[model samples]
Target: MKNTEVLEERITAQGCTEHLSAVEDAIYVIGGKWKLKIIIVLQENGNIRFNELQRNIPGISARVLSNELKDLELNGFVKRVVHAEQTPVVVEYISTDYSRTLQPVIMALSNWGKTHKRNIREDAF
Candidate 1:
């Protein structure tokens, strides 16, 4: 079955469509591979310049990083500050308080990932 149909069935089975929809909305905002990584880095580093952000996230193209940052900013998870007074303008990305709400979710995902990896290794043996 298609993913949506599967999700619908799961929602129906669990009788928690509202919760599922909220999760879908959360995923829509921060579901991508780069979005969460960028948020985590920004949260850790406080404020980072464009090039510095790109360097912190290896393997992300400049274009993709730009797009992701825009999305995160639009979603209120990140703030883009530009300083034009300097001879060379400086732009920085910082995580917003809204992004801190995802801390529990991130921790849960991290713990689950570790458990999943251990389970997979055990199964492989």
Candidate 2:
């Protein structure tokens, strides 16, 4: 049998636990309500400062945003740059190269979400 076939058999025989584990790992990093929102915002607008992101997100508190930003930074999905040139200093967050790799996945999820919402609306009527 082909190598692909053998791997497929292993996955199938193992109840697809490996696939589930991979998905769970992704969720652990980006599962929160706000992580994807932050990612989407950064993707759409490029780099942004803390206050700017809070303003764009709407309904997110300073504390929560801070925590999420830290988490994203910790996970290597975002980079924080601090500019000390100004008196008060400037801080901005931008997506890492790794995060950019997720753009297609994000866009696909977004489109699927829109369709799901429409389906719900139609079903409700």
The candidate scoring highest on lDDT is 1
TM-scores of the models, in the given order? 0.86, 0.86
lDDT score of model 1? 0.90
lDDT of 2 by residue, 1-125 (tens): 12342443444745678788889999999998899999889888888999999999989999999999999999988899999998799999998888888889898898979978988898899
lDDT of 1 at 97: 98
In the predicted model 2, the residue pairs found to clash are: none
What local distance difference test score does each model get? 0.90, 0.89
**Number of clashes in model 1?**
0
At residue 22, what lDDT does model 1 achieve?
A: 82
